[model samples]
Target: MKKFLVLGILFALPITAYLFFASGKNNFARLPVLTEKVKDIDQFKTNTDSVISFRDKISVVAFFGSELDDIKGNTFNLDQKILEKYYDFNDFQFVLVLPEEAETRTQQFVTEFNKISESSKWKIAYASPQKVQEVFDSFQSPHKLDENSFTPYVFIIDKDLQLRGRDDDEDDGKLYGYDSSNVAELSNKMNDDVKVILAEYRLALKRNNREK
Candidate 1:
């Protein structure tokens, strides 16, 4: 009876440990996709006449509108909190969508920001006001753009062009965007969420390679 009990304990211990670790990995939560198939930004043109699209990149997108002076501080806050941190990630980018009229202002802003940090991965796309509204509307989020077509909030867009955010967020039930002026929200919530999404993709890539 004693020998049978010992054997049962030894067998169950390893199985229990395996189950515990495997469950941790399998249950790792991904940042939820709040909206699906967001409209791509291919219709816009960059300063270099290059095309920018959301097809295969994890993008942090913002709208600066034509009044670039108003959001200068907001842009800096985002640069320090988010862009400076994840700009080096292979498929990660910070894309600013501005009205075509803001081209000169955008250039000066970019040059000013570059003096502080590398801005190569910071892309600027210019489109008409109507077209900018068209793209923003496609997000299907509850947030709204101001009369100037500017929002102090920035959004996270995944490789599939889907909006990624918390559905049961503590502050807002559904958090569609992060307020650029709020440092705490960016440092804590946005920082952690970005890490989660990046890790999610890395794991997926590893799985694909293994299958191949």
Candidate 2:
């Protein structure tokens, strides 16, 4: 019994540390800006005209779908309303992205939203399933793989193509979710996380003006 107990304790340490630390470092290391974006519309319809590059400005990418009847009300509707409301606060583009499979459902959702409100705050688009997976897989977060892999997830990439905040990081550092998804999905509780990034962006603009 004593020998068995010692072996179990030894085995658990590496597994536990990997789960808590190692994988998260890989996720944090992935630069969100360089990832190719996919949307819910067809190729021809996708807004490739102004395809946002990390070189231009910071961007907020939210994966949204109303197709899953189970989560539409709680997750989908709330996602739209949040983007529409606080959109005026920053210059960053807030985009609505859906996978090819979610097209019909997303179209209906977008149309209904446009009817109820009038704003250019959100731009909707479509992308391929494989492409979306490629973006998420690069982070290799197993927790994210199980659920949000094929659906809506959020990522905030700074001008340098670094992923700063994510809804789900490996663990809470400084007890914060300072990730893109939290700001996109939760909207209220952790908005200051988003504000801090924006504040930095503003300061850069000020510095640039002074340099001129």
Best by TM-score: 1
Pairs clashing in candidate 2?
Answer: 39-126, 39-127, 40-125, 40-126, 40-127, 41-126, 165-179, 165-180, 166-179, 166-180
- Per-residue lDDT of candidate 2, residues 24-95 (tens digit): 343333322233332222232343465444334455655544354544443444445444555666466665
Which stretches in model 1 have alpha-carbon errors above 4 Å?
1-27
> Cα lDDT of all candidates, in order?
0.86, 0.49
Q: How many clashing pairs in candidate 1?
A: 0
TM-score of each: 0.86, 0.57
Q: Which stretches of candidate 2 lie over 4 Å from their true place?
A: 1-55, 65-71, 74-82, 115-120, 139-153, 166-171, 174-189
Tens digits of lDDT, candidate 1, 71-162: 87898889998889887898898899888888877777778778887765688888888888888988988878877789888899999999
The lowest-lDDT stretch of 10 consecutive residues in candidate 2 is 173-182
Q: Which ten residues in a row have the lowest lDDT in candidate 1?
A: 19-28
- Cα RMSD for candidate 1? 5.1
